[model samples]
Target chain A: MNSVAGTGLARAVGRLRGSGRSAIGRWFVIAVPYFWLALFFLVPFLIVLKIAFSNIQLSMPPVEPIVTWAGDKVFQLRLHFSNFTFVFGDDLYRAAFLNSLQVAGISTLFALLIGYPMAYGIARAPGTWRNILFLLVVLPFFTSFLLRVYAWMGLLGRNGPINGVLLKLGIVAEPLQLLQTDFAVYLGMVYSYLPFMVLPLYTAIEKLDLTLLEAAADLGCRPTKAFFKITLPLTKEGVFAGCLLVFIPAVGEYVIPALLGGPDTLMIGRVVWDEFFGNRDWPVASALAIVLLVILAGFVLLLQKVQAREKEAA
Target chain B: MTGRRSFFVLSAMVFGFAFLYLPILSMIVYSFNASRLVTVWDSAHSPTLAWYVELFHNDQVLDAARLSFRIAAVNATGAVILGTLAAFALERYTRFRGRTLFGLLTTAPMVLPEVITGLSLLLLFVALDQAVGWPSGRDATTITIAHMTFSLAYVVVVVQSRLATVDRSLEEAAMDLGARPWKVFFVITLPLIAPAIASGWVLAFILSWDDIVITSFVSGPGSTTLPQLVFSKVRLGVSPDINALATILVLIVSVGVAILGVYMMRRDRRRARDAQAAFAVIP
Candidate 1:
């Protein structure tokens, strides 16, 4: 009876899989989001690219339209590469971009150093405890992002708990310059993005085969050695994924640097925000954004290629 | 098994959690301080709920909260419908023309910097309004749409993962038994993936609610979301009432997440039992 039922299930699945109507279903699933995104997500980049070239004018929208319908059959196209030149030429823009890259890279390193063991611990924990631990990791994520950053302000303030502890413990006589510094910015970045690092690593570590480690152990390999050989290579993708997750957001992180860092700390996200709102340089801001997108898109495509290669090798 | 939980790893877990929760716990503690200044503690009238009362009475906060809630709700619903469709396409229909572009669209938002997305989207809206007289202004309508675009990517991530794990044989079996593709999806696939969809909804809602960057660009005057309002207020310095607001938000989220977690675990166990029973009858 069981054999017959299994055959029936297989036959049913096969027939449905081959059905022509399923093709319509497939298209229905694909077309809706495809159209929605093509209009909303993809087309916006085209507009950004267009606006990046057009001259900024004191109009209501703050930029002249790129394509103007000059008298019949003569549509004038204005392409000013000055915005790109200005973004590239400005020392401030270059500094902010490089600083952002540096800050994000270092923060990604810190998060990985902190997140990997926590993820491994949680992934290896006993069943019920694992879920509870996972929930605990995710709990803060459900709360207000701004408030958590605000919390850091309180904690790192001269009059806050950290200072109080330092003074009471006789560690220092005066309050440290904790807030409005690069240290505070990095700390906030690591804290905000640690969960993003941990989650992917946890998923990867959880799927790791234990028997391989056991086999290595039986062959008289040290635990650390076995881990280095069997585990590290296997979870490299997760680490890379986690690093990307942290790095991308951290590079463009505005709230952390704005709330936590002082005047000297420069980030490109802040630069873009200032140019668009403060300076009212729409074209330059659009140009900055376009460059940022190109760089990020390059990284993403590179990751995709590497992952595809890994899959093929596997 | 014994080697799995090393002293180093266990300590790391403890330390990691401490780093995560200490900021929040301090925030909650400071919210109740009697002093007007958030950083200072007044020993005489400590642990007052004065700020909570102030939060309730603040008209700006109340209005902004209402706006954020409205936008988040609308965004969540729109994102789920679009996200589910996208997830079904990516997971079930693996091979198709433009599949690469479709996948890129679905995932790119997750990694795209908000400033770029916001700037580009604002430009798109401006050009669209200029070309066609529809969506004549940037307001809650535009903010909600912007939120949906980003938040749907998250919804897709969640729902697509769930879809990948779902037992496809059940869906195919129903289709083979003469149920229409749409009907099979509605009746069978939907139930199986409902938890993911629900979580996706909640995630989308929170992301939209918590967003400041995108909303700052897209939202016009008088359409201030709670985060934007709070951001503008707190950009200068900290305040006691914002702490009160934070504490309240954390409490609400904790309760909601706890309930969802427990419910999902129970459902999973019950489903496991049902599967066992069904297989027993088959044998």
Candidate 2:
């Protein structure tokens, strides 16, 4: 749907068409949101970058200015590499970064494995059923995320039903410690973000031109091969969108880790949270955040470039 | 289509829905538990609503709900306006300079971690208060702004997707009929995209209502929201009161969404019938 860069002729047409009756109205459409985002979103990241470069201090704001007027009109910039150095050098921070990547990657994989079939099913279902199934998938999202995670705690707890059934059926000698484990954290992530994975996949699959698949079948392609050749390639956008939607935020997810994860499952999100609120180390926290942002930014750019290349090829 | 619903797909649907809902069902059951311990089945007493009664009287929760309701309403309204503008710009102003950067800025909040967004925004507020003395002190206003910023991204995503799918030819027809650009939008495009705008507003409101991560950082003294209160209560362990709260929220949302879903389905059917009647297709 995002053509990215249209033909020059098309772009000109778009530009000409965009000129409404009044120029002020056209400008207002773009300017209001443009200024709002630049102020609220872009400016905050710049502030984070500025804070990351400054030394930690004990104050209300908790960081000194990176650039200050020193002496008489001689501007001095004080930059500190200590925060970045400490964050990168520390084993704790290092482990958290690695763990966050590993956990998020694996969770995205599971979410895909589960979400793909469900999305395909829903998208391909009969018309009335399709609407109902889509609503079912999204209904949980209206509920509180925190409570939903909390629901996992109850369902997987020692005294919860999973254990209750297993123990009652004499499947185990004792109740398993399900809560506050890596298993719980992964379960929480997959459960919470499953809708994110399913929604896009459903949209993409629903948009699939079935004639292509029928044409492939008429050409003697097997059902499985037809799916792999036509459906998979055509739905790449949805897959990419779904994976990005799941993976990016999952890396910096604090609630799941803090609630469901064990001490060993130290994600970068929790580390940043602890540094800021626990130790009151704003500089280190900002530095950690910047490092995480850089990693995420790289991933985003690479994914988009790869997708664009594919789009161009097709 | 019937043949398409293979056993594999059916099982996936069953298992997926089961996995999604069993925990919620457990919460509902526990909320009615006659026992204080959430995980335990006070089969004798849990079939009671004592916890629900207790919470309805709790002033802290009630006050937090009131404040959160106000913030969510404000955030939703502001976010819808901003998001509609952003979405229209992205879809219609296809050749604007720096459109890529504008898209990135709008979508980045959706991709960025709440911790980072919260921290960066909190830092911005701190810096602003210190430098300009505008916010003076972090409070509901700051929290509302934070919610607006974060939720607007969702609104943009929702509204933009809908806008991209809208038939521009309808607007063009209006324009050709002596309608101005704004008038064309108001008469044609807005009605077509009303559902998307409504969903976007609901989503923004829900995001604000359920937020704890960002709200924790931006909110100041005496500005605790419902989710924050729930988090503190649930962090220790399972509690029946929280379970009851979950039950109530789920019930309210289920009722609201079900009604909305049915109403939409009925509306669509009626429209289809009207179209058929206009053409005298059946006769």
Highest-scoring model, DockQ: 2
lDDT of 2 by residue, B195-240 (tens): 9999999999999999999999999988999999999887888898
Candidate 2's displacement at residue A136, Å, is 0.3
True contacts kept of 2: 0.81
Off by over 4 Å in 1: A1-28, A70-72, A308-314, B1-5, B264-283
lDDT of 2 at B274: 97
CAPRI-wise, candidate 1 is medium
Give the lowest summed-lDDT range of ten residues in model 2 chain A. A1-10
**Chain A only: TM-score of every candidate?**
0.89, 0.89
Clashing pairs in 2: B32-B46, B33-B46, B34-B45, B34-B46
- What is candidate 1's local distance difference test score? 0.91
Evaluate every candidate with DockQ and list the scores. Answer: 0.59, 0.62
